[model samples]
Target: MSSDAELLEASREDAGAFRELYERYALRVQGYHRRRTRSDDAAHDLTAETFAQAWLGRARFRDEAGGSAGPWLFGIARHVLLASVRRGQLERIACERLGLFDRLDCRPAAVEPQTAWLEDLDEDLDRALADLPAGQRDAIRLRVVDDLAYEQVAAALDTTPQAARVRVHRGLGALRTKLNHSTEASR
Candidate 1:
């Protein structure tokens, strides 16, 4: 097996090599974020950011202390996590200083009925999602809405990644069929 340093070097020139590197560690890093974060959604966001940062900084990767890239990746993941935390903290502090906290909505996933359009579609999609079996609905929610990696999706669902993927696919297919019917009826 080639060392991660070698893989990183190759990754600079070959996208496939980079994909291989990403495959080697993405789940572990995502799991690391998941364990530390409050919710899978936050963990998903941090994991995406971590991999993006790692890709951008691949040239800077050093094979320190036994040539495994896991430590280097974890370092980047840590920084990403800290940056996310700091951004939240700074935003909260700024909101406090500016007295915007009372004006701001702190909750997640609020779909306001005030939209001129698409609100109906949002409700339709919500209803369609609700109509799905719990396994499929939860899988779709975690994989699509929250943007969790399939591995993380599996962990949350207590199933294999492939099974989680199948549930998401089936859920989306059902949603598409239901929405198509709804659209035809409305027209």
Candidate 2:
């Protein structure tokens, strides 16, 4: 099997190999953005940009943690999402400008969120996550939001596993308190 790292290296030499890399992770990448963004169209746009940028940066990419390129791709994605938030332009349409619109075959799927109650809970959770400090926030996201193991979380955050565990623990504790209070107030 072609490891993601090997595929990435090949992509640097033969651009077609980049498609293999994208094929391997496209769903994971798209799902991440789709879950976080308010609309599916925006997620599809960001997902496309993420791979496009990754392809453009293949020359500089290395499997720093000696593992799959999955983590590195995700890191790029998180940066892209953060930049969108910082610019207050999360809804900005971008694929047409990049001239790469033909690449993705994805379209907004037919679906509805579970219920309005669940949507309210999601909003509350987002507010709690936003209120966390950067360290704790990233830790919780890599560990919980992304379901990364402790070692993977540490590798992604450039921290020790122990520190990653601590941050996630503290972050979850704070989130619980915030949520408990919110629930009580609502009741």
Candidate 3:
């Protein structure tokens, strides 16, 4: 594979090079969107939008500050997926206003006890995460879920490695506190 710099340089001058770059990053970008959206069709749409935006904005690409174009494309995919989610939420609100759910399939499914407990745990985890400051939450996600190195997380967050470590530690501590409180309340 060509270096990102070389690929970017070629893409700046040639359309074909841009296509190659898109091919290289498209699957990863789609997977990122899929994880965020939980829908394959939406992921495909977001991936297409990402590439379209990238192609249109290729002339403005900067090799210095942004690092590889892959991450930038993934960022675009993330934004697009987020926008889609917001739009869907708004649409649901509008539909509720019009009483559309009266005619829709609204059957409820039975939940198994194990599944219910897992769902409750997931909700608790989400609440705990939301209670954290943005930097702390991001640090935890990047380090634990993304499996990024401390240095990489620090660089992404524009902070020092030590600061990133502290943020992750604090975030985990806050989560543990919430979990303990939740367990006590259940008992």
TM-score of each: 0.52, 0.49, 0.47
- What lDDT score goes with residue 121 in model 2? 26
Compare candidates 1 and 3 on TM-score and give the better one.
1
Query: How many clashing residue pairs, candidate 2?
Result: 0
lDDT of 1 by residue, 134-165 (tens): 99999988976697989999999999999988
Residue-by-residue lDDT tens digits, candidate 2, 1-187:
7877788888877877889889988877777667667567766877998998898888777544343676567667776766655433222235445554466532212322222212342576689889999999999888766979899999999999999888987777677677557645653
Query: For model 1, which pairs clash?
Result: none
Residue ranges of candidate 3 with Cα displaced over 4 Å? 65-67, 91-187
Local distance difference test, each candidate: 0.71, 0.70, 0.66
lDDT of 3 by residue, 2-69 (tens): 75556767887777888788777777777655544556776677788888887777776644222356
lDDT of 1 at 147: 74
Candidates 2 and 3, the one with greater TM-score: 2
Which 10 consecutive positions of candidate 3 have the poorest summed lDDT? 108-117
Separate clash counts for every candidate: 0, 0, 0
- Ten contiguous residues with the weakest lDDT in model 2: 108-117
